[model samples]
Target: MTVAGWETRKNVPLVGHQVLLQYRKGTSGAFVTPKKVRTDRDGWATATVKATADGAYRYDFAGTSLTRATTGSADFVDVK
Candidate 1:
């Protein structure tokens, strides 16, 4: 199945916000492929990942001239 995630601010959808999708493997590997995505009309950002080991995923919002930086929560994936 495909995995997806979203972003919001102060209960409002952050439409067109830039999000970076990242992943790290088994608590040892560095994060890779900071995929760029723009928030949709509903503040949603989605990424598709194929994993070969257990790892954690996170999304980062690099602060822009007008927007402060923030990070999304990390979720772990156990690949079989």
Candidate 2:
């Protein structure tokens, strides 16, 4: 899966930082593990995930830098 998100500060892109992705399966309260994706110059980060069994997966992002810190989440990713 290609995961993309924007890192910004005060309405401007925050570049050259690492965004962490944590994921879990349906109804699971704990995330398996975390992965890191680096943002581009425009503050966009992408992560390519490997294939998995068809099920509902949830994910979230956390990014931290010298100047900023942020977090976000999304609905389950349904793979049929």
Candidate lDDT values, in order: 0.74, 0.55
**What residue pairs clash in candidate 1, if any at all?**
none
Number of the top candidate by TM-score? 1
What is candidate 2's CA lDDT for residue 62? 51
Instruction: For residues 20-74, write the lDDT of model 1, one tens digit per residue.
Output: 8988878767787647888888878887767778988999877656457887778
Clashing pairs in 2: none
Question: Which runs in model 1 stand beyond 4 Å of their true positions?
Answer: 1-11
- Residue range 38-68, candidate 2, lDDT tens digits: 6777767777676364333333445343343
Q: Model 2 scores what on Cα lDDT?
A: 0.55
State the lDDT at 35 in candidate 1. 73
For model 2 the TM-score comes to 0.59
Clashes of each: 0, 0
RMSD list, candidates in order? 7.0, 6.3
List where candidate 2 sits over 4 angstroms from the true fold. 1-10, 54-68
